[model samples]
Target chain A: MKAIYKREVQSYFNSMIGWMFTAALTAFIGIYFMAYNLFQGDAYFSTALGATLFVLMVLVPILTMRSMAEERRSRTDQLLLTAPASVTAVVMGKYLAMLTVLACPLAIACLCPLIIHFNGTAFLLSDYASILAFFLLGAAEIAVGLLISALTESQVLSAVGTFGLLLVLYLWDGLVAYLPSTAGGSLAGLLVILALVCFLVNALSSNWKVTAAVFVAGAAAIIGGYIAASDRFAGLLPDMLGRFSLLGAFDSFSVDHVFDVRGILLYLSLIALLVFLTVQVVQKRRWN
Target chain B: MIEVKNLVKRYGNHCAVDHLSFTVEDGQVFGLLGPNGAGKSTTMNIMTGYLAATEGDVLIQGHNILEEPEAARKCVGYLPEIPPLYPDMTVLEYLRFCAELKKLPAERRKEDLDEVLSLTHLNGQAERLIRNLSKGYRQRVGLAQAILGFPPIIILDEPTVGLDPKQVVEIRSLIRHLAKEHTVLLSSHILSEIRAMCDHVLILRKGKVMACDTPEALEEKLSAGGALELSVRGSAEAVRSTVLTVDGITSCEAQQEGDTVKMMISADGDAREALFYAFAQARQPILEMRPKTATLEEVFLDLTDEDDAVAAQAAALLADTPDEAAVQTTDAEQEGTGDESDL
Candidate 1:
C-alpha cells in the first residue's frame, strides 16, 4: 500500500498534474480572496472559500482523472493486481495519494484566516470550521472523481464524466427545487428513484432475484405508506433530495457560521461510499 | 508446484480455455505451446489471479488462487504478455516499487534487487527511465521485477515476444538459469524455443490440449511410421517397381528429375537395407538414401493444421501410440471421427 501510494504521488508530480492542479486552485482561490476580503474589505474568510468551490469542480477532476484509468489503459493494473496486496489496500493507497495532493492547496488556504485576522476582527473559530468543511467537501468530490476514473480506461472520458457529475452536484439544490412538490408527484418520483436504485443494484450484482426482491419490497413500502397518509407524501421527494445537496451542507458553515456536524458526517460517508465503490469496480473487473 | 483443475474460461459464448488441467512439479521448466488464440495467456492470467476462471480452480502450493489470493500470489511471480510497467519511473525505481509491492523484507530487498538486476543484465540500464528505454530493455525490467522476490514459481506469458533474436536467446538462457531453483511455467508459440527450453510441453489448439509430454517423447510418439527418401539413377517406373518389392513398405511416391528418380517410401519398419539390395539386384545404382525423422515443427503443423489428410495422418500416428487417450480424444473429436460431445 505504501509502495502504491508513493508511486502514485510521485507520478502525479512527475506528470505535472499535481503542479497544475495546485497552481490553478491557488490562483483562483487567491483571486477570490483578493476580491472578497482584501480589496472589498470584507472580514469573513468563509465567503472567499465558498466562492472558490467552483474552482474545485474543474481542478479536482484534473487531479484525479488518471489515477486508476491510466493504470488500466497502460496495463499496469496487472502488476498491482497480481502482487501480494489486496484490492482494498490498493484503492486506499491511491485514495490517500489523491487526498495528499488536495492537502497542498488546503494547506495554503489555512493561512487565509490568519491574513483576515491581521486585516480586521476575524471570527477565527468559525472561519477555521468553514475551512475544515471546505476540505471535506473537496475530499468527497475527489472520491467521486476517483470512482469515475476507475469506471473507464480513457483519461479524457474520466475527466469529462467527473466534471459532468460534479456540475450536476454543484447545481443539486437548484435542481431539487424544480422537482414536483405535490403528493402524487412525489409518490411517482419516489417510485422512479426506487426503480433506478434497483437498476443499479442489478447492474452491479447481476442477480435478478435480489434486484426483484428489493424493487418489489421498496415499491410496496412506498405505496403503502403513501396510501396510508397522503399528506406525508406531499413535498417529501424534493425535501429528501434537498437534504442530500452537498453544497447545502457547506452552506451552514460558510453562510450561517455554524459547524454542521451532520454535514461533516455526510462528507465522511460520501468519501467512504465512493472509495468502496472504486474498489468494487476494480475487483469486479477481474471477474469480467 | 501448481495444480490447475478443469480450468475453463469463457468470454461471452466463446470459450477461451476449455476444461484445461495440468500440473507443474518442482524445479521443472513447463511450457504451454499453442497457436495464436489458443488461450495460453488467458490461462496464465487465471493462474496468476489476474483474471477469474469461469469454472475451475488453480492451486498454488496447496492454496487456492481464488479463495486465498494473496497467499497464492505470494508463491508465484507473473510477467504478463505486456510488461506492466510505469513509464514515468526509472528502471531502478520501478523495480524498487515492485520489490515493495511483492512484500520483500526490508533487509533483503536491496540484495534481491541487485541480484535480479545483474541476472537480467540490466545493471547498466538501471538508471534509465523506462519510457526512454527500448522494448527489449523494458522487457528485461519486467523480468527483473518478476524475479525480485525469487518466488518458487515464476510464470511468464510469451516473454520472448517482440524481442530480437539475440535478446530472445539471452532471455531463454536467463529463464533456464531461473528454472534451476524455481518452477517455471512459460508459454510460447515458437516450436523451437519450446523444444530448446522446456522439459515438458503442452500443445494446445482452439482451447483444447492436443498433446502434453516431453519434446522428445512427443516426437517419438508422433513419428510412428518411419519414412525414407531415396534417389536412384534410373527410370521412375523402374525405381517404383524395385521399391514395391521391399517388405514392410506401405506406400511409395516417385518423382523423376533428369536422369534420377526420387522415391519417398513409407514403411512400418526399417526398409533401407532391403531397398538397397533390391536396387543392387536390379543393377540400378542408388545415388543417395536418407531416413526422414519428424521435426517438432512438422509435428506442430500436423497437429494444428486444418488439412484433412495431414490431420488424419497425425491422428492415426497418435492413435498408434500407447496410452494417450487425451491426445486421441482431441484428435478424434477435431476430425469428427469420434463423439463430438467428448470435447
Candidate 2:
C-alpha cells in the first residue's frame, strides 16, 4: 500500500496534474480572498473559502480522473492486482494520494487566516474550522471522482461523469426546493426514489429476486407508515432529500461559523462509502 | 507447484475457459499451447489471481487463490501478456517498486535487484525510462520484475511474442535458466517454442483441453511409428504387389504416373528393409524411401483445426495409446497429495 501510494503521488507530480491542480486551486482561493477580504475589507476568511467551493467542483476531477481509469487503460492494474496487495489497499493508497495533492492548496490557504489576523480582528477559530471543513469537502469529492474513475476505463468519461455528479451535488439544495410539498406528491416522489434504488441494487447484484424483495418490503413499509400517520408524510420528501445536500453541511461551518459534528461525520462516512464502492468496482471487474 | 481444478470462466453467454484442469509439478517447464482466443490468457490470468474463475478454484503451494490471495500470490510472479509497465518510470524505479510491492526483504532488495538486472541483461538500460525503450527491452524489464523476489512459480504469457530472433533465443534460455530452480508456466501459440522449451505441454482448443502430455509422448501417441513415403520407377501394380509382400505394413496406398509409382505405407514397425529387398527383387528401382515423421506442427494443426474428421482421427490415435491411463493416474496422485496438503 505504501509503495502504490508513493508511486501514485510521484506520478501526479511527475505529470502536470499535481502542479496544475495546486496552482489553479491556490489562484482561485487567492482571487476570492483578494475580492472578499483585501479590497472589500472583510475581516472573515471563511467567506473566501465559501466562494472557492466552485473551483473545487471543476478541479477535483482533474486530480482524480486518471487515478484508476488510466491504470485500466494502460493495463497496469494487472501488476497491482496480481501483486500481494489487496484491492482495498490499492484503492486506499490511491485515495490517500489524491487527498495529499488536495492538501497542498489547503496548506497554502492556511496562511490567509494569519494574514487576516495580522491585519485586524480575525475569527481565528471559525476560520480554521471552515478550512478543515473545506478540506474534508474536497476530500469527499475526490473520493466520488475516484469511484467514477473506477467505473470506466476512459479518463474523459470519468472526468465528465464526475463533473456532472459534482454539479448536481453543488446544486442539490436548490434542486430539493423544486420538489412538491403535498402529501400525495411526497409519497409519489418517495416511491420513485425507492424504485431508482432498486434498479441500482439490481445492476450491482444482478439478482432480481433480492431486488424485488427489497423493493416490495420498502414500498409496503412506506405505504403502511403513510396510512398510519398521514400528517407525517406532508412535506417529507423535500426535507429528507434536503438533508442529503452535501454542500449544505459544509456551509454550516463556512457560512454559519458553527462546528457541526454531524456534518463532519456525514463527510467522513461519504468518503468511506465511496472508497468502498470503488474497491468493489475493481473487484467485480475481475469476476466479470 | 500449481493446481487448477475444473476451472471455468464464462463471459456472459460465452465461456472463455471451460472445465479445464491441470497441474504443474515442481521444477517443470509447463506450456499452455493454444491458438488465438483459446483462453490461454484467461487461464493464466486466473492462475495468477489477476482474475477469478467462475466455477472452480486454483491452489498455489496449498493456498487457495481466492481464499488466501496474498499467500497464493506471494508464491507466484506473473508477467502478463502486455508486460504491465509504467512507461514514465525508469527501468530501475519500476523494478524497485515491484520489489517493494512483492514485499521482498528491505536488506536484500538491492542485491536481488542487481541479480535480476544482470540476469535479464538490463544493467545498461536501468537508467532509461521504460517509454524510451523498445518492446523487447520493455519485456525484459517486465521479466526482471517478475524474477526479482525469485518466487517459486513464474507465470509468463507469450513472453516471446514480439522479439527479434536473437532476443527470442535469449528469453527462451532465460526461461530455461529460471526453470532450474522455479516452476515455470508459460503460454504460446507457437508449437516450436513449446517443443523447444516445455517439459509438458497442454494443448487447448475452443476453451477445452485437447491433449496434455509431454511433447515426445504426444507425438508418439498421435503417430505411433508414422508412415513412409516411397517413390519407385515401376508399374503401379508391381509396386503395390511389392509393398503388399512386406509384412507389418498395415495399409499401402499407391499412385501411378507413367512408369513411376508413389506409395504411402503405414507400418506398425520398421518395414523399410523388407520393402527395399522386395522392390529390388521385383526390379522396381526405389527413388525415394523416407519415413514420414509427424512434427508437432502437424499435431497442433490437427488438434486445433475446425475440421472434425482430422480431429477425430487424432483422437482415435490418442485412444489407441495408453497416455490417458498415465494422465489419470497422475491426476489421482495429485488429488491425494492435494488432500494431504490441505490437512
Once superposed on the true structure, which residue ranges of model 2 sit more than 4 Å away at CA?
A: B224-226, B231-263, B278-289, B322-343
Tell me the TM-score of each prediction against the true structure: 0.94, 0.92
Give the Cα error of residue A86 in candidate 2, in Å: 1.0
Residue pairs with backbone atoms closer than 3 Å in model 2 (clashes): none
lDDT of each candidate versus the true structure: 0.88, 0.89
Candidate 1: lDDT of B100?
A: 91
lDDT (0-100) at residue A253 of candidate 1?
A: 97
**What are the per-residue Cα lDDT tens digits for candidate 2 across A70-179?**
99999999999999999999999999999999999999999999999999999999999999999999999999999999999999999999999999999999999999
Number of clashes recorded per candidate:
0, 0
For each candidate, give the TM-score of chain B. 0.87, 0.86
Q: Native-vs-model 2 lDDT?
A: 0.89
For residues B13-38, what per-residue lDDT tens digits would candidate 2 score against the true structure?
Answer: 99999999999999999999988888
